[model samples]
Target: MAYLTQPDYVKYICSCGQLKPITSLYFCRHCLKIRCGFCICHEVDSHYCANCLENMPSSEARLKKNRCTSCFDCPSCFHTLSIRATLVQPRQASTEASGDAKVENKQAKKMYYLSCFNCRWTSRDVGIPDQPVASGGWPERTNPFTTRMNQLLEYYKAIALQEKQEKLERERKKFAIRGKYITLTDKTGLTGAMARNIAGLPSTDGGSSSAIANFVASQASEEVEELPEDVYTKEVNLKQITSMAQRLASPEWQPAEVSRLHPLAKLLSVKRSQRCRACDHNLTKPEYNPGSIKFKIELLAYYHVPEVKIISHESMKPGEKAALLVKLTNPTGHEMTIKLLQPEDVPIVEEEEQKSIEKSLEKSLNLEKDSYSWRAICRPASYSALCRVREVTRDFTLAQRDDAAEYDDDARHDADDVIVWRKSNKLALRLEVETEASAASGAPARAALALQYSYRNTVPPAGNQPHQRNHTLYTTVLLDLGHVI
Candidate 1:
């Protein structure tokens, strides 16, 4: 028999039907099947300050609450204090004669103060005890707002939830009375109340009078559930909490201006996740850290806007029609609709034989520079003379601007990136011609190509974002002069 490899030890199935690496999956012998970080429970084995790394026993840790005993947040700005120490000279126990005798003294102990540079907060200023070590010796503080804020927040949350339940009940009744269909509960031999109970919601058929009275009693009670004493001991200093509240409430406050900060702030920003590559179960969040780890969340900046640009064809023969193209792209994560318009001077026209070229040329040609001239004759010499050119435009969308974005403007002339030329809106010209007809035999031809393009983009604001106009107009045209061939 041939021995088989362990079938990729890293690849394993979790209880939640998600395929994840063994590194990300944990084995729960009790649960049998593989357990991923997402499906398993997280119980903190110990409580310790990140700065001190001194693990404390559960019972003792509970006594001081979960917070570190030696550390404290700045009351003014809530930043962790950095302990600093200085050495001092020790005095001898007995005095020695200046020149006759001398005595050896013991080494002196140094004292230092911990300070918060961001908020100018200091431990010495608040009367915290000095520690032998420079780090891991901070004082802990308790927040006074803890009780009131918790009570207020819970009260509003409960009120909102109760309102939602009431609205859902009304909607259910309306749909039920329609009689067009039977609900799953009705077909399963269960009443709506029974289903609601199974779903963990309170029964809705209690007497109106009793329900109203019960609701009133519940709302009148202001008491909030108390946290476990051990958890409760993890108190936040009132001063620090107050400072944070003020900063949050002030519209003018900027995070850049605030100084004091916890050292682990960046570590908290690291996003750790365990995902089941196969099933994508617990789809919203396949991996989550235990409640013990206090994770931090923040928004940096939003990137959502459409980008656009234009390109023009190189200089063409004096009598030939010039062509140009415009490209638009959406650099944002969302899709966008856009519109483009041709410049006023560059009107859309169809190809046609030249008409009254003599009159048109007479109006455009400059007599002062008429040393030479050039002319374009249609395949059939009988065709009418060409006088002006026509313009054209198109529309499209671009996906997110990732690393692959590339810009190509090879067709544009060296003189200018933009161009503008006049033409009839309804009629297309075979081509526009501006040549110096020789006042005498064969003169030299010299003329400039003038072109310009104009356009508009339409995009809607994202949800709840304030209505604001955001679009840019790029206008530039090139004028190149060359000898007529």
Candidate 2:
């Protein structure tokens, strides 16, 4: 078991050469390889409001600027604001009726306003009026530069479209075969104007040209504003002044005083799915419903790969052997045959397989690069030279996992020179760790070992392929022993 406070003593090597704990790695069943977060592609599946748990379409979320219209966050503390209601008694108005004074009692009505439970801030603090109905009745403040910003956006979009059209026209003219006769209708059935109209691009003759001509660029000002003479001498009230976080919470206004701060709309959260970049198979896909915390598909390495835990180890000394006790557990339902080998003994076929996978991925993605750029950038440096794994030339079989066997205390003592004891699906192995003579004192004593295991494929074979249930897979793990003495 991995401990939260302690460092990772054992780390499995990912297919991308990244060393990660088994808990953090993912197994791609289709590719039959280990994958890490750095090598996966993440896609946003859906967006929803965390406060209200209301799911919204991607287009709608984009329209709302990825913020929930109904839910709001407190400007002072940036906490979720709750709607509070209070009864408001109506004031009685007396008028001269038939030269006599009359009094009438009015019924009380409930009014709702936003309040933050964390900071005890309310809409009334900012002089915002309460609404008769709850949800979405609060006023919205519009940016003063909204019109200018929209104009700038349109101008840039038109400029980009104009450039694209010019490039296309140039390429077409260069490749066109001159015809003796000019036909009214093109053979492709899509004229330039018709294509532009279909793409919602402005006509070449007017739309973009007019937008470019009408756009006015802003001029930089040289003048600087002078601060008030009492700015440094004035007694400052820290409570009344808004902090940087509070001001940034409502970025549209960025109010310097706490009284000018307004409640901010809650930002929308997205549910994302992680896919293996090489195989394009989903490793994890969460459910679409915002309220559900479960997943539709979760292919974690913990369920498929064999877990290795360091039980105990002796102190390391240069050019000396130390006793190491490790527990290996088969997480799969089927029994597995495991063989321990030196890290260098593992065949180079695995690297060839990775290259083939990368080729396939590049072909599918139409990418010029051999593989994802992150794989090359994020690979961890190897530390296998610090210590060496002693030769163990025996294979052992681990039984399938049984939940009922966990409660039983009777562990089988089918022990050997390497095997210490055995339980259901688990085996404790006593191994020898040999440190290098040249290893520096106080440096970490690291050893790398490879495991060749038999894995049963649960996924059904696709197409006319033979049903191969069991396949041999190899994985390398690094062990961190104590510093050399």
Candidate 3:
């Protein structure tokens, strides 16, 4: 079991050399390897508003600047703003003729405004008119430099396109070979520029050249504006002035005064899926519905990998042996035969299998030879040199997990020195740790161990071949012992 405040006692080594708890690791069924965040690919699946639970397409979200149109955040405290409604008497059409009439006869109208309960801030505080509808009628403030910003954006986009075209042309020239016969288009005087124009695309140089020529650069001014004479002598009112955080919340117009602040549009949240970089197989994918927190596919390591937890350990002294108790739980449904070995004694990947994995990765992901994923797969497991695993020659079998067996009090006790106790699929073992003689006092004590276990492949066979039930796999773990006395 892991605690929030306590440090991790046992950590598994990922394929990419990262040490993480099993809860934070992922198992790729296709690759049959343990992967961490550094060795996987993340992709955004969808965007939605957390407040309204409203989903929007990628194009729509981009157009709206990745913010929810209906939902807003408070400018004062940066909290989600709630819509508040008020009933107000409507103005009389002919107030002069009905001056003697009672105002109670007039009909009342419902109006809505944004309110922040946390900070007690309201839209009326900034002189914003109440909306007739409860949602989505709030007035939007436009940036005064919107036109200039658009021009700058267009100019940069054109420059990027021009650079990309030039790069492609250079690469083509380097790889192209002279042809004896000319194409029909080339013979008919239909150049690439004309073809692009015919396809409704901008001409190669004309569009970018024109944009670059039309761009206007801002000039620096020599004159400086003078501040008010009472600027330093005036008594400051902090309540009226906005703080840096409040002003920066809206980057377009950073309001210096509290009265100039407005409700900010709430940013959109994304639902992303993770995929194994080597196999291109999805590790986890969430449901499309914004309201559902469940995932459609989740291949977490907790379900497939055996979990090892440090139950208790004795204090360690230099060049002395200490007793360690570790609990191992088989999470899989199939019975597993586990053997503990030294970290260095773990078997290396066979040449044939390694070549096959490389080929598969190349076919699936089109990865380069020097890519990070390829390197991680080819690299060997790394462990600290200060720690060594005491060899345990015994092999134990753990029964398949049974949910009903957890309630039973009967636990089969094996008459072995290593096996302490055994339940349904969990067992506790007593192991001895020999500290290095050169280990210094007050230094961290760590022990490295490797597990070779049998795993049952539940996925269906690709062809008409029979199911391959069991396969052997290896994993290494590091245990943190208390500091040496």
Candidate 4:
């Protein structure tokens, strides 16, 4: 018989080709195979401005390119630009006392500029003027490339028109083979010259005007509207100014100009991506939005580190405690904090071996470790010829039966919630095994131990917001033991 604190059997080979515990393998149904972080591809799709919720399409993105029209980066450090405001006393009218004094306007309402506090990059640096009010109502600037852009746009339009004409010509020829295939002009009792005259397509260019005149005729009308001066006035006083501005304006602030900042700075962008170091696989892409503190997560199939092993045990008498030891290590440079997320929180593995046991014991273990942690799970696997397994236990250590909180829908899952609490690398545990006379023929029985850990990745997101959010890492450890009870 199997006892509590012990598993019935352990798996030998990982779903991947490597020999690892059932815990260390990730089952991928889409690929119908086990995958380690070593094999996958990751790519970034787009970087958007969160405040405006205006995402740029990739093609348009390449041209507008360096800076977003709606979004601005600090010119000094290139960090995402945040809006800031200052209240001015509005120059007080100085000649108010004299009866014959000239009338003075209310202290020419003071004008303050909106600027970036991080790198001393002011809206003024990019020629962004101050607003009359604290928020909104900033002047919009037309692009300087308007003329060249218009020409390019027209060129594409013309090309599209030419392609359409060619397609129509092809269709006409295809249909010509069906019968007499008389041309439209032939059926209508007209020749090519007559048809060209009727269709409005020029057969010759001898009488045409200058190319510039033709271009002018084909071009759309241009109209420019200017905003009234009153529209630039700041009607409302902006009360809250963040400390970021003061920090940015401080003379002490210095940011590195190297490309190394690319990985970290990209996190500030609405959409961020990172490539794996081992295989250069892109592991996570998050949609970072400034207006809201929520984000979208896209976890790639690769990049899951794994652990697998085989455990053996002797015969088991009823009610005896057994123990198994498994070790975990991080292969990446950045610190990774972990927890044992519920099985539902993890993606399903598609292997048949993974599905053999339905409802295998599992639970979330609240953790508190920073880069690494250790804990134990207690279970009994004796009488039913089946093994009982539980999730990796951390500090939370709930009982066998208790209701736990379900994961909330917040776009941001706090990093502090799932870390494990461990002062040292070592962890201790006890397992009990029981045996029955029928199976006491002296043959050793076997059981499997499954362990899971959920961790937070230290890598930063790819776009503008480097510190926006954290990526959760999940891994499993498996051990199998056989011996007498």
Question: lDDT by residue for model 2 over 392-475, one digit each (tens)?
Answer: 888989989888899989887764788888999999999998899998999988889899999999887679988878899999
Identify the superior model by lDDT, candidate 1 or candidate 2.
2
Question: Residue-wise lDDT of candidate 1 within 204-306, one digit each (tens)?
Answer: 6444334344442225667888868776668665543434453543323322222332221101111233222222222112213333354332111112222
Clashes of each: 20, 0, 0, 69
Residue 57 C-alpha lDDT in model 1 = 62
Q: Over the stretch 42-89, how does candidate 4's per-residue lDDT look in tens digits?
A: 344565655455666667666654235544544345566666656556
Cα deviation in Å at residue 443, candidate 2?
0.9
lDDT sort, best first: 2, 3, 4, 1
Q: Candidate 2 has what TM-score?
A: 0.88
Compute the lDDT for candidate 3.
0.85
Weakest 10 consecutive residues, lDDT, candidate 1? 421-430
Candidates by TM-score, descending order: 2, 3, 4, 1
**Candidates 1 and 2, the one with greater TM-score:** 2
Q: How good is model 1 by TM-score?
A: 0.30
Residue 330, candidate 2: alpha-carbon lDDT:
94
Query: TM-score of every model?
Result: 0.30, 0.88, 0.88, 0.33
Question: Worst 10-residue stretch by lDDT in candidate 4?
Answer: 370-379
